[model samples]
Target: MNSSFGIKHIAQFILFVALQILLVDNLVLFGTGFCFIYVAFLLFLPIGISRMWLLILGFITGFTVDVFYDTIGIHAAASVLLAFLRPLVLNLLTPRDGYDTNDSVNIHVMGWRWFLAYALMLILLHHTAVFFLEKISLQDAWYTLAKILLSTLFTTTVMVILQLLFFSPKRERVDYR
Candidate 1:
């Protein structure tokens, strides 16, 4: 990657991780679904990025968050899993026309339906893995499952709202000669 692209991602990494640690982590929804908005950084990565890089980015992001959360490697594990599964999820949801190099995995570009499906699936997977790993017991299976579902729904909502507010679709200009 070029210097600028690298720099942009670095900035995003810092911005997301800080927000997760300092802000969203404390914004627990009814003392359950902690906002993991940091995952959006991985979700919003460029479509053309290599799988290896995806894994690396995911690990680094999760590891950074884990450092703050002091929860061993739960975040890292979930993030890596999400990164590994990302391509499979994209392949499963590939459009009939396929993807454009310039196409991003944002709501505007992928449409609300595709974006929701994609985000919800990943968010649920990540939350399930994280909560299960954190609890590490079936003693309260029902409660754990409820936490996973609630966290997934809350995190997914936050991701969608952030996309709607901050990120916009690129528009190509039309020229007539």
Candidate 2:
């Protein structure tokens, strides 16, 4: 990353993680769903970032949240998993025209349907990893599933709203080269 981009990402990382730890993490919906907006930091990372760096950053991000949440490794594990899966997910969802390396993963850039689908898949996976790891047993399988679903929905919804309110589409026209 260039100096300016690195600084921008660092600032975003601090902001998202802080908001997650201080606010969203505490706001559990119906005592089950937790809003993990911090994942957006991972989601919005520049396309084609190295997998190794993504994983390392994911772990660090998750570890930071784990420290605040008192759940060691759970967040780290989920974050790493999400990071590992991100490229694969992007590939799977790639349009015939392909994504611009400079483009961000936001509704404005990708369109609402694509953004929703992408965010839903990642959020569900992330939430499932988290709730299941926290539970660590099938004793409350139904409850775990419910928590995963609800949190996934809640997180995805918040992400869409954030994109709508905060992110603007890239203005440069794609060349389709």
Q: By TM-score, who's the top model here?
A: 2
Over 39-141, each residue of candidate 1 has an lDDT whose tens digit, in order, gives 9999988777789999999999999999988999999999999999998999899999997754567798789999999999998999889999999999999
- Candidate 2 on 76-112: residue-level lDDT in tens? 9999999999999999999889988767677877888
lDDT of the candidates, in the order given: 0.86, 0.87
Highest lDDT scorer? 2
Give candidate 2's TM-score. 0.94
CA lDDT, candidate 2, residue 24? 88
Q: Identify the runs in model 2 with alpha carbons over 4 angstroms from their true place.
A: 171-177
Error in Å for residue 73 of model 1: 0.5
